[model samples]
Target: MRFGMALPGPNVAAVDCLPLDVLPLILEHLTDRRDLHTCAQLSKAFHNAATPLLYRTLDVRVTMYTGMQRAIVLHPSTTILQRPEYAKYVRHVRENGAVGFHRPDLMDDCRKALKMCVNLEGFTWSDDSAEGTDEGDFMRYLDILQTLPLRELVIQTFYGLSDSVWAKLQDFSGLTKVSIWCMEGKPRILQGWSEKLGASLTHLELGVSSLSRAPHPLYFLSHLPRLRALRLKGAPSAAILEILTFLPQLETLDTEYFGAALTRYDDVPAANLRHLTVRTSSVHIQGFQQLWPWIRRLTPRPSLESFTLNAFSTQGEALVPRSFILDMAATHKDTLKRFKADSTQMTLKDIECMCTVFPNLESLSCTTMWSPESAPYEEAVQKANKLRELRLNLHDWRPTHVRLAGLNNANIEVAVRNMMLREGAALRLVGIGSIVYRGQWIYKKAEDGSDKVEFEITSNVIKDVWD
Candidate 1:
C-alpha cells in the first residue's frame, strides 16, 4: 500500500523491518554464484556480503591467465598479500601451460602469486614443453615457492632438475605433500631431495623416465620418519627398500617398475602400510620369491587393502603363477579388498586360485591367459560369493571357419546345441565378431536356406572352450 510499509499490523512501520537474524536465512537461497552476482549488483549491502564468497577461490589455470590478469586489474585495491585469510581461501592453483607462458613469465607470475597467498596451502604447475637449460630459473621458482604458506606443491615439467632444487625446497617448513615429474633421466634428483625433505614430509611422488645402475639415489630417503605415502617411477629396488626402511608410518606405496632386483624387506620394520601397487615391464619368478620373505614378516602386519601386479612380457607368456598371488591373498585375507593382475600369459586357473585366497575381496580384475577347463570356473564362482566385480580375458582368439565331415542338419543342430549348452550358463555377455560381437547376435540362415553360422566369441569363452 505504501513504500516499505505493511497494510495491517500493530505498528506498520516497525513490522516492515524484519529481524537481522532473518536476513541470513533469506540470503541462504541466494548463495549460488549467478544469484549472488545478481544480488550484489542490486545493492551495496548485498555486494559487501557477497564479495567474500566471490573472491574466495582464485583458480589460475595456464589457459585462464587472461581471466586472472583481468581480475588483478579490476580488483587492484584488493591486496591478497595483506589479508591474513588469503591462505585459507586460496586452496589450489593449477598452472598447466597452453598459455605460452614460458619460464620467465611463469617465474614472475609465481613470485607475485606466492607473495599474496600468505596462507596458501596447495600449488600445482605443469610445463610440458622441453626447454630451459640452467638450474637458475628452477632455483628461483623453488625459492619463491618455499616462502609461500604451502602445505602441498606439485611440479610437472619436462626439464630435469638438479640436486640444488632440494636445498631450495628446505625453506618450506610446512610442506606436507609434493609431486614431481621429471621427463628425462633417472630420478637421481632423489639422492639429495629425500635428505632435505627429512622427517617432516608426509606425502611424496616422483616420476622419472629412467633408473640408474647405481643405488645411492635411494639412500637419501632413509631419513623421512613421518613419511606416509610414497609413489615412484623408474626407481631401483635397492632405493625402494632403503626408502621403505625410513617410512615407518607409510600407508601407501606405488611403484611404476618392479625394479631390476626383487624387493628384500626382511630387515625393515613392520610399517603401518596397507596398500601396495607395482607395475613393471617384466618380473622374474626369482624376484617374487625374494619379496616373499619380507611379505611374510610384517610384524604389525598391515591389512593389505589393495594389490596390483602389472607385468609385461615379450615372450607372450606371463611367468608369475597364480600361487604367488594366492599367497598374498591368504596372508592378508581379512583386509584385502581389491586385487588386479594384468599379463599376457597368466591363466584363469591362476585367477581362480587368487579368488579363493581372498574370500572377502570386493573387486577382482585381470587380463591374462584364460583356460576355462584348468580354471575350475564353476568352483570359483561358487567360492567367490563375496566378489562384487569380476573381469577376465582370454589370451588369443581369431576367426576361422570349420567344415564338418558329417554335413547334415542333425549334425549342425547337435553341435550348435552342445556349444550353447556348455557355454551359455557361464557367459552372460559375449563378444564374437568385431562389430557384431559387441552387440548380441543370433545365428541366421542364408537366403538359399543353407546353414551359414557366423559369430564372434569373447576371450572368456575362447578360454573355456579351449581349456
Candidate 2:
C-alpha cells in the first residue's frame, strides 16, 4: 500500500483536514501506548503515522509459554507475507531471555520479523537472564540479524565470534556501532571487523573480558578510521593514548585508568575533540599525571568544551596538579565551558585559578577537590563571575567555612549576576532559550555538624548539587 498516493479511507479522511504539523503536535502529547493504538485505529492517516510510533521499539521478551513467539512478533505472521506494511514501522529490536529454538514456529516468527523490518537501525540481545543459555543456537540469531539493515548492534551473551559469526557481521555492511561482552570468538575478530567497517563507524564500545591478558590490546583500534566517539573501559593509558593518535577526528572520548604504563607519545592534537571524560580505578598520583598526555596532545586553542576527571583516591585524598588547569587554558581557554574534577583536594585558590584559566566556563563541578581552604574567597568570587552552573562541595564543617556561606546568605550572587549583566552580559531567559537566571546557590548547608549540606531543587535548566 503506497501511502503517498493511496486513496484516503473514510477513517483517515476525517483528520486529513488538520494541519500537517497538527498531527505531530497531537501525537507528541499522546505518550500513552493505548492512546496511540486508539489513534491508529481511528483514522488511516493516523494509522500510517501512529503505527510507526506504536511499534518503533520492539523488545522481544523470551517466554516459557512455548506457544509460538513468531505469532507474538507480527500478531499475524500468516498475513505478514501478504501485507509487508509492519516492517517500516520498526526501528529498534531488543531480545532477552531464552528465545527457545526448539520451536520451529518461533524461529520462523523471528525470521519473518527480521526479514520484513528492512529499515531497522538497532538490534540488541543484552539480557542478563540469557546467560549460560547459548545451547548451540547462536547462529540462529545471526541468521535473523543478517537480514536486517542495522546501524547499532549489541551482543551480551554469545558463545564466541566464530567464522560464522564474523560472516554474519559481514552481512550488516552498514554496522557502525557494536558492543560485545561474552566474547568467545578469536582474539583477532575485532581487528578484522575494524578493517571492514572502520570507515563508517561513528561510535564504538568494547566490554570484553581479560583485556589485560590480550596479545594486542590496541589491535581493534588500529584499523578504525577517525570516528566521533570511542569507549574502552579498564584499558591501559599507554594503549589508549596510542589508539587516540590514530583517531584525530574524534569528538567525544571516554576511557578508564587501571594502572597502565604512561609513556610520552608524539602529539597529534585532536582539533575536533569537544568532550573528554577520564575515570580512574583507584586514586594514584600517577593516575592524575597520566591525564597530561591527553590534554597536552590537544591542538593549541583546541575545541574542547567539556572535561570530566573522576579520580577516586583510595585514602580519600586525591590531588589535581595546578599545571593541569594551565594546560587546559593553553589548549581550550576560550572554548572550555564545563569542568568537573571529582574527589581532588584543591583549595579555593585553585578553583579561582581555574575560573581564570577557563574564562568562558559556564559550569564547574569539583565538589571533593576544593577543600580545607577558602583563603581566596574574594578572588575566587571575582574570577567565577561568569559561571552560570557551579557545584563546589568542599570541606566546610564550621559556619566559618560553610559551603557558599558568604554568597548563599547575602544577596551577593544577585549582585554578581547584576554586575555581569551590567558588563554587557545578555539577560538569559529561563526555559525559553539559552542561559537564563533561575536562581543562584540552589542548595544550602543545613548547619549540621555531620559534614552535611542542603540545596534548593528547581526543575530548571541548571542544577548545582552541593554538599
Candidate 3:
C-alpha cells in the first residue's frame, strides 16, 4: 500500500503499490479525459502521470452549438500561456481558425503558445467560418509552427487558400502527412508543394469535395513515391488505378469515383494495395454499370485486403452488381477481410457470394431488401464462419424513419438470435434495419468433460469500437 494514500482506504487499494513507471501505463487505458483530469488532481504522482496525457493532444474546435452561447468561454490556448510547464507536453494541436479569428487576445495567446510547444509533432488549422481569413492572421500562426518539430499538417479552409498560402506551404519539406480539404475551390495539383514534400510525405489527402469536375488525382499524387495512404475526393474513377503504377509503395487509397468510363489505365499492373475505398453518386443505373468495370480492373491487384464503396444519390437504386462481387471473389477472395457497401443493395445471392467466397471476412455491411416471406438468411449465416460483424440497411421501411416499419425490436432480436446460434458461428455483432445487436458466446464445461456454448444477444444502441 505504498502509493495507496490517494484513495479513501489504503488497505483496500493495495494494488496502488504498482511501480511509478507502471502507473502511467495503467492510466493509458482510461479513455475519458474527464476521468484523467480527476485523477490528475488526486495526488502529485497521479498529476505527473496524467498531466502529460491531458496535454499531449489539444483540440480547440468551436462546435456548432457554441455559436449560440452568450458567455465568452476561455480558450485552451490561453491556458498553455498561463501554465507554460504544460506546453512542452503538447505533441499535437488541432485548432479551428474561427475559434480565435474575432478575438485578438486568444489569437495572440495561441501564437505565443505555439512557440513554447517545441515538441509538437502535428498541427491542424481549419476555418469553417463563412467569412474569409486574412492572410496576415493565418501567416502569424504558420510562422510559429515552422519553428516546431511538426511532421503532420492538415489545412481545411472553406474559403480556398490563396496563392501566397500555397507558396508558404512549400517550405514544409520535413512533413510526412498532409491533408488539404478545400470546399469551395477548383481542385488542382499543388505540384510545387508535392515536389517539396514528396521525399518525406507518406500520407496525403486532397479534396475538391463536390459531385463533378474533380481533377484527375494522379496529377497531384504521382510525385510522392513514399506514400502509404492517400485520400482524394472528386477524382475521376477511371484514372485512380493509374496512380498505383507510379507509386509502387502506396497501400491505402480513398477517392471519389465519378463513374467515368474506363478509357485509359487499362494496363495497370499488380499492386500491393491493402485498402481501397471509393465514393460516388449517380442518378441512373448506367453510373453503376461504369462502376463495375472500374472495379473489375482491380482483378490484377490480388493483395487487396479491404474494399469500401460509398454511393450517394437523390433517386435511383444503389446496387452492387453481382459481377462486381464475383470479380472481387476472383482476385481478392482470400485476402479481403472487410467489405462495406452499406449504401448499396445486395441480394441474398450477393450476400451468399460474399460469405462463401471470402472465408476470411471479418466484417460485412450492405443494404438488403428484406421481407418476412423472403428465404431465411441461412446461406450467409452458415458460410460466414469467420465473420465477426454484419451491418444491414433493410430497405423494407422508409429511410427517413429510425427503425424499420415492418420489423419490430422483437423481430430483430429473434433474427439476431437465430444467426448467433448457428454452428461454429464467430459472429459477434449485427446491425439490421438501422438497429444494432451485440452477441456474446457463453461457454461452459459439460458434464461429460466437453464444452457447451450458449448465445446471449442484446440490442446495443451504442456502437462498439470496431463498428
- Give me the runs in candidate 3 sitting further than 4 Å from their true place: 1-8, 11-13, 19-30, 42-46, 61-73, 185-188, 209-217, 373-375, 398-406, 409-412, 441-455, 461-467
- Every model: Cα RMSD to truth: 13.3, 10.1, 4.7
Work out the TM-score per prediction: 0.60, 0.68, 0.86
Tens-place lDDT per residue, model 3, 16-126, is: 465679878978778888878877877666788889999999887454455664334346777898899999999999877765654656777777888899999999888
Give me the overall lDDT of model 1: 0.54
Evaluate all candidate structures by whole-model CA lDDT and list the values in order.
0.54, 0.60, 0.75
Best by lDDT: 3
What is the number of backbone collisions in each predicted candidate, taken in the order shown? 6, 7, 0
Question: Could you tell me the TM-score of candidate 2?
Answer: 0.68
Q: Model 1, range 1-467, lDDT digits (tens) per residue?
A: 22222134444335335564554455555536676565455444444544555555554443335546531212211345445454445555554443334323345544565556655577776666676334565565566666666778887778655556655655566568878787864454445455556756899887764244335556556767788888888676555665665667888888754534545554655465688877665434444444443344432364678877666655454555555665666568778878766453445566566656777776666665423232344444345546555555445453222211122224323332333334422222322211111212457789999877665432322322222
From the highest lDDT down, the ranking of the candidates is 3, 2, 1
Query: Judged by lDDT relative to the true structure, which candidate is superior, 2 or 3?
Result: 3
* lDDT tens digits by residue: candidate 2, 134-161: 5345567667667677789877754445
CA shift at 387, candidate 2, in angstroms?
4.6
**Where in model 1 is the C-alpha error above 4 Å?**
1-88, 96-115, 133-144, 162-166, 185-196, 209-215, 256-269, 283-302, 344-346, 368-379, 397-467
